[model samples]
Target chain A: MYKYNDFDEAFVRERVAQFRGQVERRIDGSLTEDEFKPLRLMNGLYLQLHAYMLRVAVPYGTLNSKQMDMLAHLAETYDKGYGHFTTRQNIQYNWPELRDVPDMLSDLADVEMHAIQTSGNTIRNVTADHFAGAAADEVADPRPVAELLRQWSTDHPEFQFLPRKFKLAVTGAAADRAVIKAHDIGIRILERDGVRGYEILVGGGLGRTPMIGKVLHDFLPEADLLPFIEATVSVWNRLGRRDNKYKARIKITVHEHGIEEIRRLVDERFAEIRPTFNGVDQEVLREIEAQFAAPEFRTDGVDDYDIAYADNPLFRSWADTNLSEHRADGYAIVSISIKKHGATPGDATADQMRVMADLARKYGHDELRISHEQNVILPHVHKSDLPALYLALRAADLATANIGLASDIIACPGMDYCALATARSIPVAQEIATRFDELKIEHDIGALKIKISGCINACGHHHVGHIGILGLDRAGVENYQITLGGDHTETAAVGERAGPGFSADDIVPAIERLVLGYMDLRDSADETFIETYRRLGAVPFKDILYPKEAANAA
Target chain B: MARAFTPKVITSNLLLSGDAVWFTANDTWSGDIAEAEFLTDEAHAELRLLEANAQTGVMVGAYLADAKLGDAGPVPTHFREDFRTRGPSNYAHGKQVETNV
Candidate 1:
């Protein structure tokens, strides 16, 4: 995890002090809501339907045990007893008070974390693969580049007032766990001739207008990364639409002007700005790289893990589903499911947070990661400790053997908390998870991503799910529209809409029908929902989604 | 012709707590929607909204929401406003928790 240096610490403290004064001024009527709204949003505070929401950035989704404990403390002391881990790999406290937010920020700064740039038109928190350092297929750890971007983008005067909110994601692996294709700038680290470089994709986004990013650069040398990125953002900042918020994103800019024109403009800007960069970014990156060095691994035997897998069916089930192959031998990446059956997805209670913190401290080299799929990951867990870890997780109700299964749904805090939401997403996610668990066929369904967004903002990344449920207000009632055949991996594609929407009451059963229908439709169990949908096309899935239409046709 | 104006209530979130509050008949903010001054006339509703917006120190994002004169008092007609009146369906933490008290 990246620790705050003297400069970083001072900067954060000064920001907290500034926000505290702003809050006080707002209270004293010196600053009206109009004046204070932007200030508060800059500090990651928003007045939602019921309460103030504070979105705290977890840089590249990396955290230490101490930071995790502080998040738990924030949840327990200030607002509700749990925090919602968002799809951006940040945590949102939904019920923060206006008066207590500065103090909350101060508390966050204590652990080298702050909510800065988590909102607003500024470059949001730079996210990366949660399995960056520990994934088996990683070419390099992407966190160093992510950290470099964070430092470069934070309070960057030139890009702060961009046309719209910008997002950037980086991944070191070939498989797109970071969902790089759906970001404003998606960077994939690759090696050619033993020299590390980046494949830059520009203009991809997933909101109302979903677009797969186009290849801006085939390969840019590692040294030119920051300059290249700055040039790209600068070009977009100049040309991106300012008249309409809907069309303000770089994706729209690229779409309207065409990627060829955008690329030409970016090249022109890159030529202009390339000379000003004096290798300081490289120095900072080198420093940041040291901090993200992989932990010493234990090369011990996995006899205990084998014994537990052979003896205990529950352990085996959890190991099979929740564990990912680690880069090191006898090591496994443990994804702790916050989405327990019948529980709100992405919400970890303070107790659960503390338990995860303790587990990370004791067994995971004090490193923890918040995955975009709304799960906490101990990315460096040894296989020998799997039995004990599984037992502890089971005791804490975190051992839900459903990592990529139907129950592990990615849901946004929809109408339940968001002021922008049209319908409730949490309830839908909970119902689906509970129903799927009840059916005991989640494992059979296999590697299905069910993402739900409250509205068209795609905060839930609904467009990328194998089965996407978008909640909308149709005729003043909650209606859910289903989309099929979406994939958020290397083969990223926006899921196509199936047909008409389902009532809120009918949605869970509708999903159950779709998944059960998928089982029947698949040639074999090994073929996942996405593969089945792809092989057979949308006709069969469309029939499954609209059974009434199928029945009427028959 | 424009659509006929529905019954409405002036509502905003309290600046201090960020909880939803309705402009009551007594010219004070109330957490309960029942105490809200329901305006059947569009002109009166706009005036009430202006009054609510003027209380900058007390609240933020004041706007008129669709409501109806229910058996008890003014009730939210839209699901969004209803959610504001009660709370989120997922947890009993917001207005629902306070209302129980």
Candidate 2:
């Protein structure tokens, strides 16, 4: 992780002080709610349904044990004894008092963390692939460039208030784990002829309007990354729709003005803005890159891991679901499941944070990453350490053998906590997971992703789920609309809606019907739900979801 | 022509406590929805929402929630508003844990 320099330290301290003053003014009747609301939102504070939610940035979702401990400390001190890691790779504290937020910001500053640009119509926290450096398929470690962009975008004067909230994601690997296609600006680290650069994609996002990003540049030189990104967002900030809140995302702008025009505008703006950077950002990038240097790995390991996998079925099941191939030999990337059978997705208690922190320090080389799927990743763990790490995780109730499985669903806090939600999402997700768990067929069902969103904001990324469940309020009744074949990978496609909405009571049964139907429709067990959907299309799933309509169609 | 108002209650999240609060007839915020003042008139609901919104030091995000008059007072008409009174269904926290005297 990039340690904060004196400038970084001073800037955050001053910002925290300024916010403290603002909070003080609001408390003393000197400032009205109307006056203080935007200021609060600018600092990642939201007046949610029941409380003021403070979303703290976990830059590119990378954190050391010290930083993780600080998050645990904040959870214990200022708010509840828990933090909710969001899909954007940030953690949100749902119950912090207004008077204590300034202090909380100062506490975060002490750990080189702040909530700036995590909310409002600004470029939100820049996220990257969780397994950036450690994945076997990575072309380069992306965090350094991500860190550089973080520095460049933090309170960039031109983009403080854009047409809407903008998001950026970077992926270093060939596999699109970060859902880069669904971001405002998605950068992929690429290499050609011994030189590294980025494949820039723009106008990708999901909300009311979902779009797979258009390739803006086949290969943008490494030096041009910062200014080019600035040029792109600047163009968007200027011309994006401000008339309607729903159509404000850059996706709509790109849809309206075509990517060729956007490319022309960005090129023109890039020419103007390129000079101001003057290689200063690249100079900072070199400094940031050194901090992200890959950890030293030993060549000899795996005796204990082999024995554990052979001897312990429970350990074997978890390892099968939760472990991924690491770039380092004899090392494995461990993903700790937050979606335990029927628990709330993305929530980790203070004790759980401490446990993950302790594991990261002991075996993970003091490195941890929060995945966009709302799970924690220990990027580098020796194969020998797997048995011990798995044991610790199991004891903490974090080891659920359901990573990328049907039960490991992503859900947003819907009407439960959010003020904007039309219907409840968490309960729906819980019901689905519980139903799947009771059936004990999640592993048999194979790699299926079920993402649930409260409404159209797509916070839970329901648009990209294999089975996307969208909760809507239909004339005072909670209704769920299912979508089939939504893929979040490199071959990203928005899921097609199955049929008319199902009532809250009927949703789980509807999903069960669809999955059971998929079992018969699939050509082979090797065919995944998405692959089958690709082969057979949405008809099979739709037939199961709405039997009466399918009967009429037949 | 203006549309007629449905029954509504002025609601907000308390500043200090961060708990859901309803505007009462006595010009005070109450945690219980049963103590809320149901307004059937459009102008009166708007006036009450404004009054609640003006309590900057006490409340945040003051708005109107649909409610209906019960034998006691007002009750949430929509499930979403009903959920506000009983915290989240995930776990028994916030209003779910609290007991009234």
DockQ of each: 0.93, 0.77
lDDT of 1 by residue, A105-159 (tens): 9999989999999889999999999998999999999999999999999999999
Query: How well is each residue in A52-162 modelled by candidate 2, as lDDT tens digits?
Result: 899999999999998899999999998779999999999999889888999999999988999999999998898999998999999998899889889888988988879
Top DockQ model: 1
- lDDT (0-100) at residue A205 of candidate 2? 89
Top of the candidates by TM-score: 1
lDDT, candidate 1, equals 0.93
TM-score of each: 0.99, 0.98
Off by over 4 Å in 2: B99-101
